[model samples]
Target: MSKLKLDLIKNSISYFREAVAYAQRDELDETRWKFAIINVVQAMELAFKEKLRRIHPALIYSSVDERTDTVSLKKALNRLVDPGIGGLVIAEKDPRKIETAVKLRNELTHFECEHEHEHMEAKFADIFSFMIFFYREHLGLETEEFIDYDEHQRIIGLVKARAELRTRARSYIKAENFIDVWICPSCDESTFVAQNGECCFCHHKEAVIECASCGQETLESNVIDTSNYLDWDYDEGRMVLMEDYGMEMTACQGCIETFKSKVEDMRQAQYYEYMEREAMSYSR
Candidate 1:
């Protein structure tokens, strides 16, 4: 192996070890979880790049021709899964799990966001399980090489707990017979019921309201309040008068374009009326 490939593999294993240490801490506080996620994701990305480099060193770069920067985690995964390219076959659900892990890593690294402790733990557990398999099967490492026997058992416990939680949540959702099941934004679990506006897995709640314009139900966050788009009268500290568009008007994501068009047409009409009045005054 080239020195570069050796370095990549070494760094990837090192990061994975550090991540496991953080994840298996007794306290497992927010700071520990944050670092655990960051390290594990870094490990995954390096491993991906290393695999790509093995296939073709040029494939590691974002553009093979330019060779300026390395490929992103997403890009690396795409290349690995491409039959004509890397020819690595990943599990069906692994892509989504990796995507969730990447999102959490980015959120922890670049921004501030709060996640429930259990939900975070479940996410970490899911990624950890997948990474272990990747290291053994893809990276060609023995189980004893990367993870200690005791630590491996603990990690298995974590994965099992997450699986049990999902099973229970799914059973409840099935019993309730919710028509519109969605993935929970909070937990990244497929137990959020649109009708209830709550996640069965994480129990996270969001407001679901009917769109004023389209009369279709959607998450309140997905709806644009037309009142905010209306012309404001700063001097009077109120919205400028319009005949039909009221403060209560709202448009869901789908109807926002139509709503904007209507608002624009109304503004144009008001401008035309003002111009006509100015013309009449000048004639006098």
Candidate 2:
């Protein structure tokens, strides 16, 4: 598993580099990068095929049909008759990530230049196996370290967090009081929420939930008093602040309480600037 992930990561990075170069020149060759990424996808399928053969040798495959683009690996994956392997391993790689690779592939395959960013999201998606398999299987970073999530989501969250480390802080992520925050679009931040109710800030009028802004603690059925936040009531339209907003930002027990995405907008702009500098440094 580790080796497969590493290979995919290395290949993904290769495509990412090619894509970024195109972006820097303001001339994206989707095909150039796309072809590079499909190699990774093919690698993924091959890994699956090898794994499937281990469980059952009955699985067989034919050369790719001349017409078929080979985007989906259903044929390779389904070849194994044994149900013991588990649900689609494709899901394990995240359709979102696959979509990224596919999108890059398609743009290059069909269009000429269409990638919005100078880079790929999945390329920087974070090698989340750390928070996924390693944390639990190896280091044992259970709910004690954060909220409850499948090892996959946990891995996803950690990968995102570290990838956007410049813009996000684990402390800030804990600040967003969302229920099961697998992803945050605002600052590109992510968190593991246990309890669900209001945003971290009880100021929300529509959804009143109680989420802690500090510490990782949320009960499946944890009940919090709504009237507790008397100080932060809305005064007309402005949020009336009487005490520490950090407290509200800290231990918010609300449901779906996220503030920013991976990184704050300003922070992200700065991040891009720095990246620009670094890219120049690489050439230097």
Best-fitting candidate, scored by TM-score:
1
Where is the poorest 10-residue window by lDDT in model 2? 198-207
Q: What is the lDDT of candidate 1?
A: 0.83
True-structure RMSD, every candidate: 6.9, 23.7
Measured against the true structure, the TM-scores of the candidates, in listed sequence, are 0.72, 0.32
Q: Please report how far candidate 2 places residue 150 from its true position, in Å.
A: 32
lDDT of 1 at 122: 67
The lDDT of each candidate is: 0.83, 0.40
The digit string of per-residue lDDT tens for model 2 on 201-244 reads 11111232345543444433333443244245578887776533
The C-alpha stretches of model 2 lying farther than 4 A from their native spots are: 1-36, 57-71, 74-96, 117-121, 124-284
Clashing pairs in 1: none
Clash count for candidate 1 is: 0
